[model samples]
Target: MKTKIILFLTTVLLSINITDRGSASSNYFEADVIIYGGTSAAVTAAVKVARTGQSVIMVSPDIHLGGLSSGGLGFTDTGNKEVIGGLSREFYQRVYEYYQQDETWQWQDRSEYGNRGQGTTALDEEFGTMWIFEPHIAEQVFEDFINDEGITVLRDEWLDRKDGVVTEDGRIVSFETLSGKRFKGKMFIDATYEGDLMAAAGVSYHVGRESNDTYDEEWNGVQTGVYHHNHFFPPDGPHIDPYVSPGDPSSGIIGGVSVAPPGEKGSGDHRVQAYCFRMCLSDHPDNKVPFPKPDNYEPSQYILLLRLFESGWHERNNFFTKYDEIPNRKTDTNNHGPVSTDYMGMNYDYPEASYERREQIIQEHEDYQKGMMYFLANDPRVPREIQNEVKRWGLAKDEFTDNGNWPHQLYIREARRMIGDFVMTEHEVLGNREVPKSIGMGSYTLDSHNVQRYITPEGYVQNEGDIGVSPDQPYEIAYGSLIPKKDEIQNLLVPVAMSASHIAFGSIRMEPVFMVLGHSAAAAAVLAIREGQAVQDVNYNDLRNDLEADGQVLEYSD
Candidate 1:
């Protein structure tokens, strides 16, 4: 294991192009634009900046690039394909090209696989954009992007948030990573899911749901009475006790249940939505990695699942409903029912926690997920019928090949949202208000995963904070949402954590949308540099013109 890691690290160090031009005095490199995060958005941002004839560097905390897109989220949540017309579409086009070759279909025959994608056509030979794919294929696409564009990428370089970001008069002068490498740039983009770079740059942000009244949005807060997706207990369904000892209040709360009262409906709290890995599982025996018991595995921790299964045994098939099979008989398994992958209420502190603590949380989630899969496959408590079905599937050994066949990134559905010059509210997303200075378009449904799992007042197990509000049509993503206020920061732009209320963010947080915004943010940054203007002061007219020329669908058809 150590040898594999060492060899992989050496290969990565050799493969990536980094400009460590100042090794003597804390290795520093200057660029016209600096991008943080190794997410798909980050890579696309670098590509856009580079194409515009500007020098750019991507300093990533992750060893792998393209974040969740390369990490196991092959089942993309792209809403309207026509609205996706920029670099985001270019990526899918590359996927399409890769799969057209006979070599790309190694695990399965092209004639055998036929899972037409969720939103856009997956293997569309006409459009030449394969929306769904394997994780390794996505990673390869991102690598190809950086290599083809000649964009420098510094992998595994974590930003030192505390003392590394040096700001002067609302502009980021330079930033240093924990490894003592420094980067100076005219513009910076935070494309990380965590919004770490934006927060470190003294950007004001929100981490949890705001009150419904705060934004006049119906799906903003507590949502005690509302259920959007089928991730909650049916109100009329039979009661499932949320305690280890049934109906005993004195007994401690169950593993997944919170003791606190779900606050008033539409009220605010500090709880964030649940996160999980968009796991890649395969039924092919030769390319399978059986679920392994994590080092910190505790059998008793999954007792709640036993109860859930016991209560809903008749719905056994429903448990496997979310196994969205991609090419090669591999599945992009996601959280479906109320008791699926999401570890509810366990990730509240992750947004602001230290890296070590965040890692611990991530490991705990990984263990819980893996252990649950193992339990279903072998536990006596689980029905033999379900066990037989689950046992047929295992990790896709061909994917995430380096990390024990585990996903390289966690599915961070929600995190810190920057409070920029314009906060995109539900009004704008739902097409009630006009979005001025359009930069990109978002059409995905407002889909938020469960935020908290708690015992209902009626003694039934319930998961709150799962919302799914569809937009009226594709809405424009405002340019102001990506940049800080004029008085706060002038050079930094945040595409991933752009200003939005919780409900609005739900629709805008899709991978394809992130890439679109990433492309837009870079275009704006390049224009700002050419004009010697702050990001906040970039001319919307000229910026819009450039974005349209670059194939960004900033507005839907009139």
Candidate 2:
């Protein structure tokens, strides 16, 4: 066992080349625009920069090209598809074109697939866009974009967050990666969900929820009793005890129940929302790999789930409610009920954690979610009906081929949001206040998953911070929200973790919107490069003209 462990460690060290000092042979790179993420936004931004006849380099931590969009979140959450435009819409159009050929349907016929999205057609012929797709197909589209533009992508290159950035009078000159390779650029865009580069560059940012008083919004802070969806304990069901021994105080709380007080209502805290992998599941016998038992699986950790089953969860049909269908008879399975995929209260430090620490957190989430599935499908304690239903699904064989058929990216719903020149609040998202300098539009309902699970005052298990609030209409996202304050950073733009209050971010953090902001951010970066100005100093008129000329939808009308 010791020999095997040492061999594995040595293999990993050599593969990463931790000892290499990054000699001049492959140490230095220069680009007109430097992107520091592998998200859908990063692809669009790179495409935009390349289309503008500028050199761009993508320094990505993950080997994958697209983030959640291609990471098992194939069922696109597009609210009002008409407002999605530019490279974002072009991406969907490419998906539409891919499915036009009969060869694209391998496991199921095209006619058998549902053409419905979030109240819209999944395959919108009129707009020439296809919303729902498979993980591999979305990734192929992003790769096609990169190949078409000749963008340089450095995959699996992590930024040295502690000492990577080299700033000169508020302008970033270069940033070093973990492998010691230095990349220099005239302008940079932090397109990561974690905002790693942005945070490393001394940019102002915020994590977790803010008090409702800070933003004067109804849905910005800790919410204890607000149940927007069916992700809560059923009110009519018998209360399940949170302790290991029912009606006993000394037995201690179960695995997921938080011991800390859930803060006063409407107050802020350091608790981040839950994180989970959006599992890509398949029911096809040839394409499915049965859920495997985790090495460190603990059945006692899921005792609450057993109690949930006893409290009528199966009769309520809650287990499989969020097993949303995608192409080829696959599923983009997300959190559904009181006890599901989400690893609540487990990712609060992820935003600012070290790379090694983040890896541990990711592995913990993977184990918990995968173990939950295994428990449900194989454990004798689970209801037979649920076990039978869960047994029908498994990991998709054709997806994430290199990563044990698991997703390459975790669904980081919210993370480090930059506190930039302009802060978007719910007032702007709900259309109560007019936003200036429109760069893009987001129409999705304000949504957030559960943050913490704890025993209620009545001694029953309950979840907190799940929110779903709809906006009156589609609203504009200001360009100022993407760039940092002029005094703080001169040439950096953050699109994925753009400036916004918590509730406002919930609406803007969608993949399509991230692509929209990425395209706009790249255009602004190019303008900044050409004009020899700070990102904040770029003229709004020129930025708007550039975006509109590229067919970006900046405004919506009824």
Candidate 3:
């Protein structure tokens, strides 16, 4: 009995931390392709490789797979669904399967739930697949793909950046994790949004927006006046005052406003776009967890929101959230209007920060967002109408329940973009240049969230780095954009953070497109391995043929 008790405890402890990379455990793994990051693309790439009868493993820092796809970004940002093929389309097709069942609509009646979508295609029902989904459902689909494909995924395994990478002769020999586990592969695919593995492998990359002159693109850099979206200038006349003391200039710029002058129109800067959780909120009373004031919540931090209200910009500026509804009465509530969920200028250090520092930033964002919810719902200063409306909604109890019903992943819109051999510019996204060696297609408008808040020259507050430019059609992404230069890294392929300018990346950074590129990247990797060639040396003709065989829409024949 004594020995059995000890055995049970040992088993329990081992099971509890089997996947924890923080522990001092050791192992070695080898695969045909080593894909880092458990993003939507990561899983799809693994699925593609597995489908092609190759061994692949995804080593991700995230315990939860499907970076933003399952990370409360259920309302997918697919532009042209027609162009989304291969493994990318298969994932959405599964979402439709999950929702078509009567048992899937737990909180809401199917007949009562109205269909919704935006321009061109109706996301609710597009013949074969459904676009809008609950967070839990999206996650389940990704998990199901893993189970069915028998893909190996090591969760919570962070890359060892300092000395973890082992490179030889411009090729990655192996990469170690924080947990001391080493992964070696014939070819590597960096599917992370942060581009950690890509950067660690000595790949040339860019951290911030490039000068328009660098890429000869018009919308690449500083534009203080562009207001393509319904932010900054509210429907009401004069913009919100940016001073802490309202009209007093000596009071210093308000907490959220940047003092730096908007740089030259086409000059480069180290500013990144704002990020916020696509909170899975719900109005369903049975599944709603009322917003709890965070441990570090401070009402004073939201003084800018109060100022907006006092300035008569409340109703017109989405005082609460842009609660885009999904299936089962849940919402993919994102930052809407100025002074919403996005905490601008606070996350400029996130992309390259230490893990601890990034954690701090993530916590700060959570607290600020939670504070906003609590303030709007209970603050006496809030208008009764706005307060009442906010009170009706809360975090979805069924989603991310283990994490206090909060989103497990922050929406990292853009991070380290690789500067590969052939950089994707506005010319390719806008269909100006004849793109060659097509891998996938991107059709979304060049949309970027706000990067900084600064006092305008006219003494009113304005936001910069929010520009929206539409593309002509589903543009083909070049294969050259996915590979590092032969001299830097010969065996690496980057799909998520592939070569692209900031403005051009805005159009190509959709989740579906990532999955498409994931499929292409894996296809290229498998071919490269079979032919005994470097990733950069893979024959584009053979790669394109394989991608097309797998139903990837490389080119749109209009």
Candidate 4:
């Protein structure tokens, strides 16, 4: 009887913790705020929580810290720099400070690199910020932020999406990970690009483009004929056939080109935009690792590209157009042209796929991209001049040191967007409607990459769903978009995957804007905890005040 009592007491103590604040054991962790993600927004949100003298735990699936910001996307897509304030601007300022040191520029001298950017200079001396930098530097800055705040971060901890969340009366009490580790907190923030937690919590969300009629907007759904960027096969330039053997229908459709008919202009579909790695490449001989052929390289995949070159598209000499140069003689190479790095139609299932399935999809993308590079650089079918230029560039030896010096995070351009109290549409983005309860501002063009590459009725291959509509001005993002319907979840905030129409999210999904929303979401979470109110019930005026106090730009004047 004595032994039984001692054993029972020990088991009880290990299972439960009783304290005003939270506690941490081998299987359980408790904190005032729990953030799930490793994106730029996740880092900013964690910093905000820790700055308010609260206990915060970051449950991240990424082994590295920053998602796209530090994952080889050094060339920032800052549409308007004025609207990017708070921690987003602070991140750029740190980049500037790091570059100011003489030793920071290694392969290339500071004066040797051109200071170019999207709409502003890369190195802004007056603003004390730098928009362009190396991948490792951005990762270091994120690490420094975590270290400065003394925040607790658990890396590579994936959420158990099957049955991990414990909710009572619309509040999330705790969520367990795949390793049986559970996290309990007063407030939660879903800063992931995929919105995994938001979906697992049974919150309503949308996976694909909503019909324009669904949101009463003009650009929400399928856009087959409208080609805003130079990412399409020019009708007059090249009539590249989609068939494997030129014009033979029995030869079957070539790889990367779909056979389905392009859907109606205004109709909705279950398709998603393409995804690719924002590769960091170096031209410097000492720091460049030549592109290697993937073990499962498929030469047949390049047949379409070879046909495009054969049909005279190679005369443009635009293969390196998107190789935007950053510091240290490296480049943040992104997708360009009709058939580039953007793996079209390959990621439609990634948003809702299981962990093992998502891994397979990711591997497919990696193999395709690696093989494409090797084909371009070494394959005899490639134009000689193009192959020579491709051979000059290779993966940066200093970036993404692990995983064979390749970026660990894929550019998940768009994913599961939460359907919450408010949904931002094109009317709000184009300044036709006023947004209520501003939490942040976004100024990027309504941009969506090519969603599919299909055979046109004319038997030629063409890309569809690429859009780039500029906003009338910097627009406010509503606070209501961050929270689920008041009845669904009371203590959770989703800033990265906030409620927005497909067109609206195209503009609102910039990295700087995400950090702004993240800071605002954390502010709201902190306020709700202090007032003992639901996240949806937090006063907008108080949230605005808190955001402004934290240097977040919630409104635009010019």
Residue pairs of candidate 3 with colliding backbone atoms: none
How far residue 511's Cα lies from its native spot in candidate 2, in Å, is: 0.3
Model 2 local distance difference test score: 0.91
Candidate 2 lDDT over residue span 203-274, tens digit each: 999999999999899998999889898888865567778998888879998889987888899999988889
lDDT of 2 at 151: 74
1 versus 3: better TM-score goes to: 1
lDDT of 3 by residue, 296-396 (tens): 77787777788778877775566554787787788888877867888887888888888899999999888888888998888899888888989999999
Give the clashing pairs for model 2: none
Candidate 3 residue runs with Cα over 4 Å from true position:
1-26, 120-126, 234-236, 317-321
Per-residue error (Å), model 4, residue 162: 0.8
Listed per model in order, the count of residue pairs whose N, CA or C atoms clash below 3 Å is 0, 0, 0, 0
Off by over 4 Å in 4: 1-24
- Name the better of 1 and 3 by lDDT: 1
Task: Count backbone clashes in candidate 4.
Answer: 0
Ranking by lDDT: 2, 4, 1, 3
lDDT of 4 by residue, 218-310 (tens): 887888788899889996655888887888999998999988887888788888889999999999999999998899999999888888888
